[model samples]
Target: MATDDIKDTVEYSEDVKVDEKQNISQHEGIPRPEDLKQDMALQTGEADHELRERERKLLWKIDLRLLPTLSVMYLLASLDRGNIGNARLGGLEADLHLEGNDFYNALSIFYAGYVLCQIPSNLMVKTMRPSRWIGITMTLWGVCSTCMAATKNASGLFAARFFLGCFETGIGPSAPLILSFWYRREEMSSRLAVFLGSSTVAGAFGGALAYAVLGHLQGAQGLSAWRWLFIIEGLPTICLGLLAFVILPDYPASAGKRWLSPEEKELAIQRGASAFNTDTSNFDLRQVKAALLDYKNWLTALVYTGLNAPLASFTSFLPTIVKTLGFTNLQAQLLTIPPYIAACFYLGIMCYLSDKLKQRALFIIIVSMTGTLGYMFLLIGNNVALQYLGACFAAMGLYPLIPLTLSWISNNQLGHSKRAVALAMANTMSQTLSVLGTQIYKTQDAPAYRPGHAICLAFTCLTWGTALVLRYFLKKENASKDKQYGVPGEIDEKHFVGAEDMYDKHPGFRYIL
Candidate 1:
C-alpha cells in the first residue's frame, strides 16, 4: 500500500462502486494528513475519521462565519419572495385593489425572472470572487426588497417582485458553491441543512418580527406597516453584503493570507483531493457544452425538480398555510419555529448518519417517502394536532433531503466549471417546477387545496422511483467496469498508475445511486 502503489490502481467503468460498507469504525485513530497519507499506504486509512473531523470543523466555521451572513442574506431573499403572504395578512390586497390570485400571479411572474437570471449570476460568481459577487448581489436584492416597501398597486408589486427575483437568484446557490469550496461530500448535507433552515426560522422569526414591526410602523412615513416590514427586513442584508466582502474568506487557495496558516492552506488544497470538480483548466463554449453533455447532470436535476416542488411550498407559503389552520398571526409564527427546530435536529442526525454510512440515495429515498406521507396527513387528517405534526413531518422529510441531494450532485460532477453549471442547472430546473407548485394552490381551492396535496404525493413517488433506478444503475455500471478492468468511474488505467494520475486515469468514478 505504498503511495506509488495506491496511485497506480486503474478503473475502467463508470459505475465503479466501492464496497458499500463505510468502514467508519476502522478509521478512528489516524490524525493529520500525513497520517492519512501513511494510512493510504497501509491500505487501512483512517480516511473516514479524517473526513468527518474535517467536516465537523468546517460545519463549525460555516455555522459561525459563513451561514449567519448568508442566513441574513437569504432571510431577506426569502422575505422578498413571500412578503406577499405577509402582505395579504396586512392590508395589501385592499390597498392595491387586487382580487383573485393576482398576487399569486405576481409571485408566479417572479420565477420568470429567476429562471432568466440564475445561470448568468452563478457563472459570474465563479469567474469573479464569490465574496465579491455574492456580497454585491446581497446588497442589490436588499435594494429591491426596499423598493417593494414602496409598491402602491398590484402592478407596482409585480415590478418590485420581478426585480427581487432577479437579485435573489444566486444567493442560495452561491452559498453551496462557496461551501463546496471548503467542505467534502458527506459533510455538505448537514451544513446545507443548517444554512437553509434559516429560511424556516425566518418564517417564525419574521412572523414575530413582522408583528412587532407592523404594529410599530403602522403610522410611520405614511406607508403601511407591511411596507415597513419590507423596508426593515431589507436593510440589514445591504449592510451584511458590505461586511461579507470584508470578512468572508474568498476560496481556500486564495484566503489564507489573513486567517488560515500556511499548513492549513496545504491541507485545504488537498482536502479537495477527492473533488468531483477538480480541473479548473481552460474554459470556453466547447468545454461548457461538453460538461452539459453529461447525462448525469440532467438526471440529477430531474430528481431535484420533483423534490423541490414540495419544499418550495413549505418555504414560500408555510406561514400562510399555517395561518389558515385556525391560528393567529402570532401563533402561526410561534408554531412554525418548532417544526424548523425539529428539522435542524433531524437533518443534523440524518447527515451525521449519511456521513457515517457513506451513502446518499437510500437516505434520500427514505426521507422523501416520509415527506410524501406527511403530505398525506395534510390531505386526510382533520385533527389540528395531527395536521400540525404533519408540518413537522414535512420538515423532517424535506430539509435533510436538500443537503443530501446537493451533496450527491456536488460529489458526482467533476470539473469546477461542470460542478458550478450543474448546481445552477439543477437548482434552476427544480425552481421551474416550484413555479408550477405555487400556481397549483388555485383560487378555486383556497383554504384547502387537495389537488396541491395530491400533486406533492405524486412528486414524492417520483423521487422514490428515481432513487431505485439510480441505485440499480450505479451498481450495474460498477460491476460492468470492474469486470472490464477494475474500479468505478470511467478513467483510463495507464495514467492512473502515475503518482499524480490515479483519479486522472481511473475510468470508474461512477456517479452515486
Candidate 2:
C-alpha cells in the first residue's frame, strides 16, 4: 500500500464509528464500538509487513537522534550532581573548613531545591518547547556547578549546591515524560535504561575523571584539584546545553516535520495516541486532580522513596565507603569504577528483559532483593573482600530500579498532564526522602557503617515489599475493572468522547499490571 493509502485509511476509519444507540452488550465478540472501527483498519500480509518495516526504521531514526543526546545530557547532569562526593575526597571538606554535619547539610540542601522545582518544571515542559526548556535549565545548572570552584566557604558551597539541584530537576523527571511522547509503553523501559544507565556510567566516568583531575590538576594555576574538578566537568555541560536547542526534538508532532516524512509523522502520532488512549492536548485540571488523587502515584512514590534513599547515599558516599575499606583516597576512586560498570551491564540486561517480558514489578522486587542482600554483606561481613563485594552488589541492584520504576509509573499513567504530574510528584517525594539518605552515612560512622548499611537494607526491603503490594493491587484493580466493564477493547478516539475528563478512568483504559 502507498503511504497516502495508509494515511487515508487511518483518517477514514477514525472518523467512522459504530452508532452510539447500539448497545455494546448486544455485540457478542466486540467489547466496544471502538474495536469495530479499529479492526476494520487492521492490515495483514505484505502491507502489514511493509508498515512494520517503516515503523522499525522510524524508531531507529528516533532512537539515534534522541536517545544519545538525552543520555549524554543526563550523564553530564549526574556527573555535576554527584561530583561533590569525589570533591570531598579531593580535600573539599578541609579546604572549606566543613564542621560536623556541614557536609551532610550541603548535600541535603540540594534536594530542597530539587524537590521544590520538580512539579513546576515538569508542568512547564508541557507548555514550552521541551528543547528550549531543557537547554535553558542545563545551562543554568552548569553555571551553578562551575561556580562551586569559586566557593571559599560553606555558605557559598551550600548556595551553589541548592541552585544546582533546582536546575538539574528539569532533566531527570522530564526525560521519561518526553520519551513517552515518542515511544509506546512497552518500548519505554529499555530506552529509559539507556537514559538512566548514563548515571551509572557517570559514576564510573566520574571516578576516573576525578582521579585524573585530582592527581595532576591539583595546584595548577593556584587552584586545588577539587576546584579543577568542578570547572572541568561543568564547562562541557554548558556547551551541550546550547547544542540541545538545535539537536533535541520536541514532541513527535513537531519533530516529525523536521526529521520524518509525512507518512511517518502520521504513524508516529497514531502510535502515541494509541498508547495513551487520549490525545487531550490542552492541559486539564481534572487530569492534574486525577494524578494527585491516584493512590498508585503515592504508592509508586513510596517505592521510589525506598529506592532513592539508598541510591542517594550510595552515589554520594561510595568513595567514602570504599575509603573505609583500607584503600587510599585515589585507590578508592579507582575502585568505585568497577561496581558502576557492573551496574551498567546489569541494568541493560534487566531493562531488556523488562521490555521483552513487558514486566516491571517482578524485576523491581528482584533487584530490590539483590540490593538488600548487598547491604547485608556490608552489615555483617567480617572481611574487606566481602564488603567490597557488597558494594558491587549494591550498585548493580540500586541503579537499575531508577529507570524501571520511572518507566513503570509512566506506563500506568494516561494523558500528558496526568503523566507529567505523576512523574514530578514521584520525583519530588523521592528526592525529599533522599535527603535522609544523604544524612544517614555520617562521618563518625566510617569503617563498617553498620547503622547506615542497616538503614539502606531496610529501605531496599521496603522497596521489595512495596513492589509486591503494588503489583497485587494493580492486578486486583485490573480484575475488578474487567468484571465491572468487561475486558476493554482496542481504544480509539471515539472511546474518549464522553471520557475526555476521565483520563485513565475511561472504561476502555486498563492499568498495565
Residue 261 shift from truth in candidate 1, angstroms: 2.0
Off by over 4 Å in 2: 1-43, 489-499
lDDT tens string, model 1, 83-145? 667666777778888888787778777787787787888788768888888888778878888
Report the lDDT tens digits of candidate 2 across residue range 208-300: 999999999989999999999999999999999999899999877786566888888888888887787355445677789999999999999
Task: Give the top-scoring candidate (lDDT).
Answer: 2
- In terms of lDDT, the poorest run of 10 residues in model 1 is 496-505
Best-matching candidate per TM-score? 2
RMSD of each: 10.1, 8.8
